[model samples]
Target: MNNLATPGMLTAVWISLIVYMGVILYFVVRGARLTTNMADYATGTFQFSPAAIGLSLAAGMTSAATFIINPGFIAYYGISAFLSMAVFLPIGAIISLIVFSKRFRKIGSAVNAKTIAQWVGIRYNSASFRLYMAFLSILHLTFIVLIAVGLTQVLSRALNVDALPALSGIVIFTFGYMMFGGANSLVYTNMIQALLKVVVAVVLLFSGYQLFTNADAGFFQQLQQIDPKLTAAFNTDSPLYRDFFEVVICQLIVGVAIVCQPHIITRSLLLKDDKGMNRFLWVAVILLILFFTVVFTGLYARVLFPDLMVAGKPLPLDAVMSAYVTTYFSPVVSLFLVVGLLASGVATLESLIQSISTTITTDIIAAFAPNVIGKQQLFVNRLVIAVMAAVTIAMSYQQLVNPDLSVGILAQNGVYASFSAAFVPLLFGMFLKNVPVQAAFSASVAAVVAHFGIYYGRLTPYMETGTRNPGIAAALAILISLLVGAVVLVLYRQTKKEVAV
Candidate 1:
């Protein structure tokens, strides 16, 4: 599509973005000043209020997926995608957060674990397992690519620039600042981002108010006018929202396990103690619910562009919101909205970069490579973040140029696989005592195998279509992992009982 954004508007956006980056850099430099070593970088030494940590947690958990990518799915598939993403998935994740957070926090705090990999090593007493998880954490780079692509689509459209320059700017600015800020700067920036997201979410959700109030035809009727299935709870025409299996059940399972991600779960570790748990959770959950509803804006985008076309050309799904924003809003309001969108993308991007790099540096590099002292370790982490940026930029550029529908597919595959593997280890470690580490390890192995096997082998009905849903593979992996853990637990208990007798 020809540049829908005018030159004057593009210039305004560029100026505002430059100002935004400057403010962000100031914070990162300040945080870097306070950061003495790798430990401080991984987990902040700053005293954070429950509200700050909670908001940061929400921002980390809700990323480009909520604000950008998933909304595209909603626009394409209608209410079925909404139900799966904004409703059922939120419920499962919130429930998991509530149940898992307190227990996990107590253990994490007690051991003073810096990374999730370290938590696993400490919990199961296995250095090799920690190393394995550190390697698996590389999967999060797919998520980073999603954010990068999402941001690139938004900014390139807004600035009327090529995708490569926009992608480079996003990766370098976000990831470069991240190498300095770590958790200390991240929480501060994320709090601001979460607040911006709250405003953006409200604006986006209500942007369709005119359609809702139409006397001749309401929103549902309007959607029905376009496609009969669009108004339905399930849209069989869509690849990702075909049935209950794909829509409701699978999403719920994925939701519950999604909390096991390093950036998501490790947020609790930022808390000073257990006392902040309830307040932290309340703030995070309430804000997250609001953030999740932003996907409803996709429905509005469909109502605006029923044919998914702009300027007589078909709009890419990833660019739908960008088109919607530029088409609807005044240049000034569009600027703020663009900032919020950037916040949504970069907040989680910052967290993922920080967490993944820290994991690699502390858990993998330190464990294997020659003894690295405090200052050296800090330097190593910065180096790791730089390397991660290079890799992410390379992958992100490919997805930007050529994607399989949306980048969500690639992200969900890698991210879901990592968390699926982590679920058993996290569950058994937090809740159960004296459990054989082998059971958790076996379950982890089985979960990864099951997820990849089903996905690649097309073992299930969900994979029969041209575009496969990763949720199906993830759900099955989680279930199989649970079963494997249960079997091992029972056998271990039986042997102990026999020995006692």
Candidate 2:
């Protein structure tokens, strides 16, 4: 029953995969038709309803980690994981998006900024700054690897295929199509992915309701029986959730800063009108809250496999949910869940590829080679994507074969570091006008140093343990960058006042 080995089931999954790919290809082709230039490819030329764009935003933001991989952590840990990932993180990100979206969109539109690097570079009037930021954006390739690995784990298990082949297929197909679609196709595809995820999210969240039937030892009590720490708000046994500070405070700050990613912030630029933006935000927020709560399903996995073993072998943290789906659900439902998880990965993967490749081509390459025409720019964009795909395959295969406490760790390290550097520049650019570019530049440099320094130096007691959590380093970096930028801004203002006198 757990294996999902029937020929019928395998056939159904294959057919579903083919249909999904066909539909996606059709949209990509249509979107590519509308995309005549780099700007059109980056932000899309078509007019999209805010509701659709908002759903697209929600899909892009909630990647495989949200629906698939993070659940594995919750399955291994417990309520504390839920608190950090599901509750605090979402609250911070949503609040950040609400506060930052309008301002970011306004400035991005005024300057006609297509990528985050362009926004930062143009705002500071530094082409070198743009190149540096674009280089930093390459860090998002880690997220691309994370999604590839997640989808591979889910699909390979569901279809009983090898991880390498599944991973290769996923990377090639998704990235191959992504080279053509850009924002135009991405919006339509993401909207559909989001809709599918909404269905799967509802099913998974309600799946565990039966566990509550026992009065003397209900669901929470069952978790308490296995490991008393599982029911606790702070699981000291887990490195990531040592206490309230790491789980709540650290995660809150990380969540707030996480919205600074290029794929995430640039989502607002897709909306052509304010009415659409408002509707998009409302739909995205409500659905995202639902999608995030899917982490609670991890607790159900714990109940089924208390020891976290699928067979003779121990279940790796990343493999927990995929194993759970294979074992718990009927074959038909398993196939559906498999596609849902695939959607989760593709949604974010498309956005990352489009954003990062566009930044490299338009902001970095084109900035230096001003004579490069639009047709050549598009060619270079596709070429960059191909190079990125190759890099992703190499990194993803390494993590798949010999992971360091889950691919999520690798992802967090790169993602947190990039966004940590970006936060200061982005925040300063948005709210504070007339501030010295040196402050933004210096703040970015400090963030990179502080983040990597704290992480590698093992500066915090939380990171002294065998399992290192990148969230600590990222949270600290955000604070340090803010402080440095604030000091610089204040000093500059004082100098201006003195000169006036």
Candidate 3:
């Protein structure tokens, strides 16, 4: 909570951030040269290597949550958070990515779909559904706000500035370049960010090496010395990691459906051909596993800040990582860590801006006013990004000032609702043949209702709690969607059979 960054560190961060902006601008200019139309902007005109695309996927999937936010949860609740976030969540997400990527890409390519909404509409032959999903895609703005807030937390601490100016600068700069870069520049930038994150992840993970060496006991024992609850398999004291259901079952379900988001699932479409699929998957999975483990740094932070305080001030859940980096590391090392932290947030933030803006421009706006977007689709897309920037600035400011535990909760509520709605449609469309559009549509609607209905309405005991878990609501929503979809599919088949008879 205190400004731990020295003047020297602030100078270093400013220089590094400026140089970083220049590098990003160079890529944006290059990518913009190739992007004459919205289509080129959406999917890129280049044939990227599987390794590059894989790194992009890894970077996009990790986001600020992996490097910056979720670790706060780990610091608070302990290993139970680690198992839920790093272990079980990745297992389910990787499996889902492997299963869905190829099939989704196949259909997406066949239909020439650029965005998730476009893919859904073309897959089911429904213009209205595309518009509906495009509107739903606006939920991703919550995620963008999450990344913005995370980046602001890091930059504000590193530069010794207030959060408002830091957030505004981040949104303007990132969204400005993203309007031009799209997929073309996003992959290259993400690949670089992923590599930087790998270095920082290693540095952060091993920063606590002294803790392991100084104590006679093992790591878990050290944690036990701090608090037995920190070493426990389940942290009953924590709201989110209270039990087996919340820690494991709910996370696994959410992980599987999490890939249904546009920036994540559409990464497969960036591949030029099917032959690259294996290499892409291999690179992404390996990097993701490494990136996920970065949450272990939270354990180290917990060791350092036993009471989660600095200078007699309590650390917010979101500020734990920032406090650790500034307080524990040397100025030069903290400089590197700060830049890497920025990269981790920027990587996925870029993807979200590109994918969401494209969806709004090509899917939603074009649906309503096709003639308005006739030849100046690129201009319209830029305008949409500008509007998104304003919205992000407004929403992120609110979260920075007053959050529900952390911005992660607000993000999960909106993002979980989105992908929960998307999961049924994508799953039924991918694996099931002759599935009625009505079934998928009905299931998507049910998912939206179920997720928000549970969260805000507090329909269940889990929701009734003060600190509600979005994963519980999301998992229930997914299950309800599956049930509703299956029932509808069966009824449709029965009606068809009766008609044939």
Clashes (candidate 2): 1
Off by over 4 Å in 2: none
The RMSD of every model to the true structure, in order and in angstroms, is 1.2, 1.2, 1.1
Candidates' lDDT values, in order? Answer: 0.89, 0.90, 0.92
**TM-score result, candidate 2:** 0.98
RMSD of 1: 1.2
Model 1 agreement with the true structure over 38-80: per-residue lDDT tens digits: 8889888899999999999999889988898888888888999
Candidate 2 lDDT, 1-501, residue by residue in tens: 145568988889999999999999999999999887798889998898898898998999999998889999999889999999999988899999898888889999899898889999889898888899999999999999999899988988777878888888998999899888999999999999999999999888888888999667799989989999999999988978879889999889999889999999999999886666778789989988998899899999999889888777898888888888888888888889889989988999999999999988987788778888677888889999999999999999999899988899999999999999999899989998887888998899899999999989989888776878999999999999999988998999999999999
Error of 1 at 100 (Å): 1.1
Least accurate stretch of 10 residues (summed lDDT) in model 3? 1-10
lDDT of 2 at 498: 100
lDDT of 2 at 45: 89
